[model samples]
Target: MHVVAIYNNKGGEGKSTVTVGIAEFLAANRNKKVLVVDLDAQASSSCALLGRQSLNAAIREGRTVVDLAAQLKQTRRPSIDPEQFLVWRAASEARGSALESMAMLVPDGDRMYDVESSMVWGKHNHLFRDWLKPKLTEFDFVLIDLPANVTKSAMVCVNGLAMSDFVLIPTRSTHISLNGLPRTFSLIDQVRNVNGDGFPTVLGFLLNATDKRNQQYRSIVRPMVAASTDGEIPPFFQNHWPASPALEAATDEDRDARTLKERFGNAYDHARKVARELEVACEKYERTQVQPIKLSLWQRLGLA
Candidate 1:
């Protein structure tokens, strides 16, 4: 199985949304058994993909990622197996067509932040990596939705990402969002140096929620990007997500997967194209012993 982390260093980048969207696309279009691990404390992806009812039930049962992280934080005792917490048939009945083969590790709202703060460097950093690494061969794809900042939860993602085959950074084309790219790469560099497997090779900067008709993006941002030194940012995907409510609404309102497929329409096509790109990247990474790129951004940011 191929594992990919959809991550970034800043908030409001739609990482969770992209995670769910691409996951559904892979499950439906590619017929892949996808496991989405909600690594963020916010639990946004959990609410989106599994809905509040399911999440609440899971939390009550103490079968969420937050609970799992808490159990792992207990360094003295034997590590509890979080495999029992996997939520099967997570999507609503309406979404069965596209999500039937999909499984999720939901997060708890109350203890999530606590789980983040409880993390120490060694004991909890590899909690997620150690737990999920064994299941890689069971699922066709394991997609992780990481928290958007440099918190302890984010470090778990960074640690887990090092073990992944690919990592995809999702963001908008705006100045504030693009500004996070450099720090994101720098964090990757730190993980590469410290983490055993080195950094997860980035798939690309996925420019989601972009407007093709907007001249501002085409005239201003695209040129700056073209002229800029983007060796640290990795390559841009050929297909990108357009600004639209349908993408979030379908999941937010708990629409069935079939209806979601109808709502996204051509957007699903775009998602499929991006998934194909990821497929190729995963294959190439596994085939070659490519070394992780030590980005110069860490030096520029005075982080190295």
Candidate 2:
């Protein structure tokens, strides 16, 4: 299975929304088995998918990622297998698909699973890598929705990236958000260094919540496109995910009665385009081939 992390250092950059959108697209349209691990304490992704408030609620009242790890380390007791901890639920029945048909495994419980700051590192440092070795053939992808900032949860995100084949960085086309790219990239570098694996290559930097009419967006897009041409960053720049009222509306209410494909036609169309780009990136990465140049570094750096 290919693993992908939807990450960015800044919050409200549409990271969680993009992550859930992609998971839904893959599961509902591609008919692939998906596992979404919500490592954030906020449980936004978990709520979007399973309607669970937190990860702890799914693990029964007595267990947590930390509790299991401590038990395993302190008492030499075998902790709960990661697979058993999965909460299985159907995707929205509005699409006429069973929960089992979409996600093969999800976090199980009612409260939310919160990753404490202390438990973020080394809970299963190499455990995910080892655990995924045998089960890699079971699914098409394992998508993780990381917390917004570089905290302990972010470190767990890096661990997920270590095991993943590609990483997608979602950002807005603005001075403040774009300015923080270096730090986010640095975090990825640190994760790769710690794991002794090369940095997790970006699938692409997705420009989200963009307004076509804005002069600022055009200004930003021009330079970013130039950078892709110059090879300052990987050339897997996907299509922009336009800002839409439908996205917010879908997020606010349960439209599960309608297939995501049917409820928001325009939004799903954009998501499908993004998914197509992702497939190409995944294919090239899997084969260890270089991505073709599409834009210049000047454009990528937003200096064009």
Candidate 3:
């Protein structure tokens, strides 16, 4: 499986929207089995995929990333079966049958704070990644929606980054939002430096909530953003998501059923195009990137 983390240190950049939209498109259109892991304590992606009611029920039952993270902390313990927390066919059945292959590991908003406070970064660093690598071989993609502002959830973000094979940044086109890109890259660099081989690489930037008429973005920030990447990967995705009420509304998780097209409304094409770009990135990363040798906990900790 090709694991991906949809992340940005800045908030309100539409990371969760991109995560859910791309996951649905990949599962429904590309015929890929997708697993969405909601690492954010906010659980926005989980609620979007499973609806608030189901997500709440799962949270009540202690079936969430918090539970998984807590369990994985005990290295001596047997692996917890992924199915225990995985919600199969997570999207609304009313949406379409195409999302049958989509699933999610919901999050707990209530207990995540306490969980993160207790976490020792080293002990939990690669625990989740190693536990998942062998058991989730059947999945085609694992899309992780990481919490914004790395400082707030460092442990969870580190683990998410270490688990992912690629990181897709979704950023708003505004100057403040664009300014956060460097920090995101800096954190990724730190993860790569410490984690060593197999650390996630930058997939590219997916501009979200863009204004087509904004000359500032078209003339200044856009090229500046592209140049910042130094042509490492495709600096910016060819397809971007524009700001639209319809697209924002799609994040709502109601009992009402809606097809993918109906859900995205006028933004259907945008979502599909973004998803296609993501698929291409995944294929390229898998084909050209070197596979990392599995390392023991002590090795990763520099204790061996």
Query: Against the true structure, whose lDDT is highest?
Result: 3
Work out the TM-score per prediction. 0.84, 0.79, 0.87
The parts of candidate 3 lying over 4 Å away from their true place are 90-101, 225-234, 287-304
The residue-by-residue lDDT of candidate 1 on 1-304, one tens digit each, is 8888898888978888888787877777677888888877688888777777887898898888777666765655445554678887644356434444578888776576666665766555565566547645778888988887764345456556665767788888776777677777766666655565654667777888888669757764574345334554366776788877677574564654454466466576777687777777777766333244444543443334
Best by TM-score: 3
| TM-score for candidate 2, residues paired by index | 0.79
Give the C-alpha lDDT of model 1: 0.69
- Cα lDDT for residue 72, model 1? 62
Estimate, for each residue in 51-123, the C-alpha lDDT of model 2 and write its tens digit.
Answer: 5443446555533433333333343334346554456655555535332344423323222233333344655
Worst 10 residues of 3 by lDDT: 294-303
TM-score: the better of candidates 1 and 2:
1
A best-first ranking of the candidates according to their TM-score comes to: 3, 1, 2
Residue pairs clashing, model 3: none
Winner of 1 and 3 under TM-score: 3
